[model samples]
Target: MITTHPFNDDKLREECGVFGVAGAIDAAAMVALGLHALQHRGQEAAGISSFDGTTFHDHKALGLVAGNFDSEEIMRLLKGEWAIGHVRYATTGETALRNVQPLYAELASGGFAIAHNGNISNAVKLRHDLVRSGSIFQSTSDTETIIHLVATSRYRTLLDKFIDALKQVEGAYSLICLTEMGMIACRDPLGIRPLVMGRIGPEDGGTVIFASETVALDIVGAEFVRSVEPGELVVVSGGEIRSHRPFQQKASRPCIFEHVYFSRPDSIVDGSSVYTVRKAIGGQLAIESPVDVDLVIPVPDSGTPAAIGYAQQSGLPFELGIIRSHYVGRTFIQPGDGVRHLGVKLKHNANRPLVTGKKLVLIDDSIVRGTTSLKIVQMMRDAGAAEVHMRIASPPTMHSCFYGVNTPERSKLLAAQKSIEEMRQFIQADSLAFVSINGLYRALGEASREEEAPRYCDACFTGDYPTPLTDLSEREQPNQLMLLAERVGG
Candidate 1:
């Protein structure tokens, strides 16, 4: 079986990251740097597509950005004034080279290439109709559906055809498309995903950038201008930027998970610092579920900021009871089952001196399968911990995400299948508590979740999906993997 990072298996995985720059010299190099910064969003594959006035050049490979694009030879092949790049984790298709993105196609008007950062919920349905009408797809990726839609649209102009194509699709998307004319960036009507605009130099003569996170902008020395408004399309043509509203306007509900886990801590999303929000979540968790302990320890990396807040708020001494090995790759060639069982240890190990005979509190962002948590708790006990209590920064995730997040089926989620006490027992922790839903909203600086209209997409916790699951509703028995596979093969 292909496994992800051993330590990250229990956390929700984001689909991808997108970066695009127009009107810049050596645009492909800048995109390479930006994608390197956004690599945490996806590590399985990386691709870059560039448009010099007439032709489009692209290079995609199945590996980390550094492994693929670090060579000057590869960079030389992708020369252009405008470029777009993508890092993918395969939300809708199999992990194949053909599915790697910046899916390109030749249209009646011109050549176009697009990099997307979300899932198309209605792709299966729309793909079936398109195949019936004789549209031959080159790749099994749902992103290819957009290209076909644009190719077959009756609209005259490329912009009109692009807008018409988007009008036919449903689900969350933050897209950056490269064309012979210019680059176009747009967010889904509901803004369930994130995209931001930035400038590298002055407005009169500068590079226009679009990225999934602001950290990408920072890496490329760009100043973030603003988030691309929900349902708004931004076009960068002839060294000028313009905005258009192509979809019917609706209340935007950006994905809350961006702040909880998907984004880099240093990145700013929707005018808020992800690190600050995570710390606030930790403080709120401490307020709602305080525990008396000798030391507060974080699970590492993702849980660090929240752990800091938890320690400060609870007035407990913070210590590194667990240390992570940064060298572990996502997948390793294990020789035997015995070696596979040691996966968690390969990524993280308990600090015996700090944990021995100490009552410790383990702070983590969220728990999904409970297997990792169970193993970590057992490791603590083996290290001679007197007691181990687990506190989660986010509310229990009881539902699967369909908006570009890779999640196990609802049945596989520990929170969905078990009660709080049942979870505590399963993980063998002395105590286990998750921050309440209202408390999470409070940490985000909201009074509470608006029962009728949520400010953010909290469907994984509350099961109140902001958009209709049309494809799921149509199926008699929905099989997520089967549906996605069929859409691809069809």
Candidate 2:
């Protein structure tokens, strides 16, 4: 057992939510609760903005919605029939209260609200262009760049300005906007982020909601319609759903990671079960990365479903070797090495009786920086597991993600830094194997025939960004964070 915590482990989620009501009266409170259900997508900050049949009201705070929103206070201020709310995890911006979403802006045409999921890879260039034109920005986020772009457009109507604004920016984004006239939602050409249109009810027959995941829809009692097509824009107003597309439509490339790790199991994604996809990934791992072992042990939580699938497919028995303590909230994860050293142990407890002197096959979703995996492997070994064969359900994460996921530097990525044999030696695993890209897609493809329409964006694997970035005039490469910071703060 290797007892070591490797450097550069950052598990950050960039997923967010956009919930709205066009026809309902108590829209703000409803959006508040809807954002709560979608909180798993992001927990750093929460915000809600609404356009009543008359006036717009907004409130955003720098903590989880549960902590920030005092119901009576927010509800008292938020009075409206139409609303849009957001929960965010910082990916392309500084983590500050000002950077939180459902960004409210007063435009020459009228008032509008915007919430964005995914990253604007070309934001640095766009921000520079805006600044050169005397555009002043209030927040340090890629999402804010779009708002500035829209504000500067020469077009007359908000819709015209918005369409022009979409043309100027590049990269993955699913944007939901609350305009004086209606609610507008658009998915990037690549569809790196997920967005679905939801029908509220038969009673409130005309109401519709837009969200990053179907789970938000389920919570709001909205029926899952279909995903907003890549490079498409849909607007809901006057109880009527309308769409516009000044930009030409491009190939649809949805993010495959949504099924791998992000989404809630119960929420349907483009017509497939998230749980089933995970299980299939596990099943594929067993077939592709087989090993002789006494027990198949999951790393707990995300690894459990895949581990079960692996166990069932491999005809090997599965055991709850690492038990996760659900009671530990984010507050329990203390910062700094003094408490950070307890990252793995505080989250999990090893069942020594099951592993004492056993050869265990450990299943995990993927290794980010080798920190958590190294620590967990050492814990298993310390628990008396003589041999630990590490199996990863996804392929090696080599490239950094610009589509709103908080991945570290490529140099820090263990897979990019070390080969399979090198990683096995580094983690001291008896053997280490990862499921192939083909196996991952194959397993997911086999799970449902209905998901064939929209192909997934595996850019993190293949370096194939579906949308061509046009505004990275200053960005020579993705790793130039220092240069980016200088430009932003200058």
Question: Which candidate's TM-score is highest?
Answer: 1
Question: Per-prediction count of colliding residue pairs?
Answer: 0, 0
- Minimum summed lDDT over a 10-residue window in model 2 is located at 1-10
What's the TM for model 2?
Answer: 0.90
Across 1-490, the per-residue lDDT of candidate 1 in tens digits comes to: 5655666679899999999999988999999999999999999999999988877899999988988999999999898899999999988889889999899888769889999999998898999999999999878888998999999999999999999999999999999999988999999999999999999788988889999999999999999999999999999998678899979999999999898899999999888999999999999999999998999999988899999999999999999999999988887766787776788998899999889999999999999999999999999999999999999989999888889999887878999889999999999999999999999889889999998789999978977777767666323235444544665695
lDDT of candidate model 2 versus the reference: 0.80
* Cα TM-score per model: 0.96, 0.90
Model 1: residues >4 Å from true position, as ranges? Answer: 1-5, 473-490
Overall lDDT per candidate, in order of appearance: 0.91, 0.80
lDDT of 2 by residue, 1-490 (tens): 2222222253435557667666677888778878888887877789998887678888998667886775697787888878888998777667678898888889879989998988887898889889999999999988889999889999999998998998888888898999999999999876778889888776335678888888888888887889988888998876678877667767667788788777877777767888888889999999988999989999877788789999999999999999888765554424567866667787787899999999999988888778788888898889999899999878888766777887776677788779999998888889999888888888778433223343677656544445555543233255444434655694
Q: Any runs in candidate 2 off by more than 4 Å, and if so which?
A: 1-12, 203-205, 332-339, 446-454, 469-490
Error of 2 at 7 (Å): 13
Instruction: Judge candidate 1 against the unseen true structure and give its global Cα lDDT, from 0 to 1.
Output: 0.91
